[model samples]
Target: MDEHGLVSREFTHRYVLPEDTLPRSVSSTLSPDGVLTITAPKKPSPSAPNERIVPIAVQGGPTPLPVQHEP
Candidate 1:
């Protein structure tokens, strides 16, 4: 880089994304004209819980596990 006269160069480009939401898939394309295009699908909605009943065996007897339900 020093030989190419590009040593110690500082970049001023910054991009920040959401911390909570995330894209499942991402697509990008770079044209011959030095143009970059990025595309992402819409965020998906939360799905219903697949309620599963799990039983645990304790020393005394069998205890039914509790299920967590999000309001």
Candidate 2:
């Protein structure tokens, strides 16, 4: 619970890839309410044999800013 009397929840999802599956990169954006919109790169690369897309949601409070990364 928070000062505003709101309960927080956390969830995580994982993906298992086949021999040909791999990860390329990850990207994310933050909403005004503090929700993060995450996107996994689908483009295939020599390093990434399998590609996966995932979106994570946090239900507690807002962060100061969103973090982003590129391959």
What are the lDDT figures for the candidates, one per model? Answer: 0.66, 0.66
RMSD of each: 15.7, 22.9
**Model 1: pairs clashing at backbone N, Cα or C within 3 Å:** none
lDDT of 1 by residue, 3-55 (tens): 77784635456455454445556676979776777666556666669956689
Residue range 1-71, candidate 2, lDDT tens digits: 88999977787877564444335555569797989786664545555557567789877986768767886
TM-scores of the models, in the given order?
0.33, 0.28
lDDT of model 2 at residue 29?
A: 97
What 10-residue stretch in candidate 1 is worst by lDDT?
9-18
User: Measured by C-alpha RMSD in angstroms, how accurate is candidate 2?
Assistant: 22.9
C-alpha displacement of 60 in model 1, angstroms?
73
